[model samples]
Target: MRATEVAMALGEPDIHKRVEVVRTRLKRLIDKGWLAEHQRGQFSIVEGLNGAALNGAAADH
Candidate 1:
């Protein structure tokens, strides 16, 4: 999902700040090799991880 989509799903009160926070956090996950930004503003779990496992791994960060 895109940062804006995540922020909206989380129901953040501050739209602008929430998007920024989500984007930053997503970048962190990318740096940790947990996720890959395949396209601008789009992200997905890295190879070798299924959706269920990815959710657990993401929660760790």
Candidate 2:
């Protein structure tokens, strides 16, 4: 997901979201291995931190 999507998931209103702030936080999470950037301006939960990982479905990724 992108920062804008993350903001929406967090319940931030469409007209009030601060994507820059969310992007900064996401970068920090990447630094800590909590998230992985899958593409430019996009991200995914790191394996082992989400259900797919727990179910062994993410091992091939």
Candidate 3:
């Protein structure tokens, strides 16, 4: 999911904190090779990972 989408889904009391959580999660995913960034802030799912986006299904939160 996109960053904006994830932020919206998080719905935390503090918007900044929510965004931070999302960013941290994305970074971890990148380190794990589950996601590949297309640009500075854009990302897509890594190939051959069974549809696991770096952001994970929890972004639907």
Model 2: weakest 10-residue lDDT segment is: 51-60
Write the candidate numbers in order of decreasing TM-score. Answer: 1, 2, 3
- lDDT values of the candidates? 0.78, 0.75, 0.67
Best prediction by lDDT: 1
What is residue 30's positional error in candidate 2, in angstroms? 0.1
The runs of at least 3 residues in candidate 2 whose Cα sits more than 4 Å from the true structure, single-residue gaps closed, are 15-17, 50-61
Kindly list the per-residue Cα lDDT of model 2 for residues 1-61, writing each as its tens digit.
9888998898776653487778888998777667899999898888776434434334434
| lDDT for 56 (candidate 3) | 47
State TM-scores per candidate: 0.69, 0.69, 0.62
Give per-candidate clash totals: 0, 0, 0
Q: Residue 38 CA error for candidate 3 (Å)?
A: 1.0
Residue runs of model 3 more than 4 Å from their true location after superposition: 10-14, 51-61
Please write out the lDDT profile of model 3 over residues 6-36, one tens digit for every residue: 6676674446777778877877877777777
Winner on TM-score between 1 and 3 is 1
